[model samples]
Target: MDGRHSRISVLMFPWLAHGHISPFLELAKKLTKRNFHIYFCSTPVNLRPIKEKLPEKYSLSIQLVELHLPSLPELPPHYHTTNGLPPHLMPTLKKAFDMASPNFSTIVKNLRPDLLIYDFLQQWAPSIALSRNIPAVEFLPTNAAMTSFVIHLTKNPGVEFPFPEIYLRDNYAISKFQNVLESSANGIKDTERAVECCEQSSEIVLIKTFREIEAKYLDYLSELTGKKIVPVGPLVQDPVHEYDEKPGIMEWLNNKERSSTVFVSFGSEYFLSKEEMEEIAYGLEQSMVPFIWVVRFPGGAKVSLEMALPKGFLDRVGDGGMVVEGWAPQTKILEHSSIGGFSSHCGWSSVLESMKLGVPIIAMPMHLDQPINARLVEEVGMGLEVERDMNGKLKREEVAKVIREVVVEKAGESVRQKAKELKEKLISKGEEEIDEVVQEVVQLCRKKNRH
Candidate 1:
């Protein structure tokens, strides 16, 4: 190839999960349209489902390289991904991912990529770029608000429990933050470097959120990390429920009155406990609104759908409810006029989807950045969080109250209106930020000091 046509190539290796991988692919699509070449890497099992979903334009656009996750005795191939893995086994997966560094190093050496864009878990990636005389960036699919908060705390380790309400009201979240702090301070050997990879990068953190929503946080992040933080326009693609074509789902939704039914999903990962599921079931029954709720159990979870919920609960809401055992095409359902509200776990990606689609959120944040994301939704008037007890337990009555308020009551008209307004502003709007980010990335790559 001659110099005139040589395109700048970026090697992107996101963490082994759908939520982490999807946003990187969306950003890859935007980058490809700008004539940038991309080498997207992930485990084979994780890539299988999404490979077929790529559009024709993207068919040959990204070089999807499969990096086999080393199979450990404790966990098999399927367990490598966050979708099915139990919450407790996350540390095991992180260790397994770090063990694959030699494999990733081989690919980077062979490709000689101009830029290395890696997930927060793979801190060693930047070393490859350092060896090759180029720059690397840490691509965080997490929203800016949470990212900023974490970085700020990382910078100021002794800030007297910075966020009082979030930390005090939600002990689960506080505990998670404590883990992050302790881990960053002293995580295990393989992960300590990976977790701190953002600081190791050449002064640029590319996140899946824009400044319009969290400007203060973004500015604070820059000051905290001393890196030029770049906002990537909340890369939220319309959810394509791989199972949306399931004739029963759309048909059942069609039968319901407009804006009367909701699509309830707790994300692909984060399986609910039996107590949680039972409370949600009772709440749905009490809300008196029709819903299509998707439920998922952890890899080794022994409970059946019948065993998981309250006895006769299914029979009680027979016609009014549709319970899906696994994945559902959430985006397609949300697009349908029948999906008036989204009962979500408030994962950043899910939060962005609800915003982009104008579907109001009934936030029930389980852990991690979710609690922070939930607060942002309420701060921006996009959704209403279901109030939790001091123990951080989600109650049936509160669930019923919020669900009815968001989907079926006159009192929540403003919240509903604000959600739709956000959709129009985010989705129906121009691609100015989307287009501008590519230019910013190009400039970042062009900077001469990295090598």
Candidate 2:
């Protein structure tokens, strides 16, 4: 308390997924601006890319710390991260993570930071922090609507979600979500882990959302959790320095008309099945809209793009499409003048990015909170969800119809206008939310010192 102007130190621990680590890094960058020193912790495999992405200026304020997970038989050092991990090894990865609790405790003891900001899962993190008298808070990168929806189900079982607009009406989605909630790693269910993490937070829970889009959901979540829900303002990545990664795509986009092209990507972790990819390709071809579609395969997957896609699809679409494999500059592309709509898997981070960049979404929610997110997208009037058939299969015609309606049709004007309005609203708000966040965090640190 003596050095009042001294910078506060925080250690950020997100889950192994790229989606989780990304927002945490964005939040760390924001905190560094307000006189906060961040210790970004993760596995070595995950840290490598982060190190490359970090600019030279942040070398002092932001330091990377590696937490080594014990290598099991099938889980090697490289497999410690979930970026390109095989689906079946998920449980093993979680087991390895849990086993690393002792190593984390060692790091915590050595660093001895004022506060710990951890992601969902790993309730053990806060327990260790508490033992050492360090205040710990949970930072969920997921949106408020989905977070509230899951917590509601966990706390009040057998009750219907109050908001009818957001639901898993698709039986396939419902079954998958149930599996996710009931699924266990190291003898703890996922939902139970989430609930416990929220309960263990010192007083406040930080979420990656803004009040303009989810005021009611945030309020409802606060009521449900009995803790203040702090919206951290979307936490979208800054695209200023990411332009050099894919110049050809940017050059192609420059030639397109304003608000005429769609950018398609699922996410880093989830690889689309062959059938799913084929359907989307046909749909895109039918729509006649210029698009830049990014395709990804799992680690050790040798399937070529030619094999995965329909025959002659590449030559047929020729100049109208750009089929990029591996990765693209998502934020950079979304912010471009040519990208009007996004054909996305509706992952929470992607959803926030689209809204922040003022690009309307052609939501094709695949699984696990995506359907609910898609529903919220339509509810807020910022996007339209593509309709699927009875068995929850994506139809080519419906996909084409929604793509046309969202991007190139007269009916989509309202959606496009709404996207721009939301973007302006977010821009005007600027750093107001982060200012409030700083106050709340400082108060927590002070209270701990007083105790």
**Most lDDT-accurate candidate:** 2
Task: Kindly list the per-residue Cα lDDT of model 1 for residues 198-290, writing each as its tens digit.
Answer: 777766788887666777777767776788888887677755546635779888998999899878999887888888998899999999999
- Poorest lDDT segment (10 consecutive residues) of candidate 1: 183-192
Instruction: Assess every candidate by TM-score.
Output: 0.91, 0.97
Give a tens-digit lDDT track for model 2, residues 86-176. 7788889999999999999999999999999998889999999989999999999988889999999988999998988888867767876
What are the C-alpha RMSDs, in order, of all predicted structures?
3.2, 1.8
lDDT scores of the candidates, listed in order: 0.79, 0.91
The list of candidate 2 runs beyond 4 A from truth reads 1-4, 240-245
**Index of the highest-TM-score prediction:** 2
Clashing pairs in 1: 241-329
Where is model 2 poorest over a 10-residue stretch in terms of lDDT? 1-10
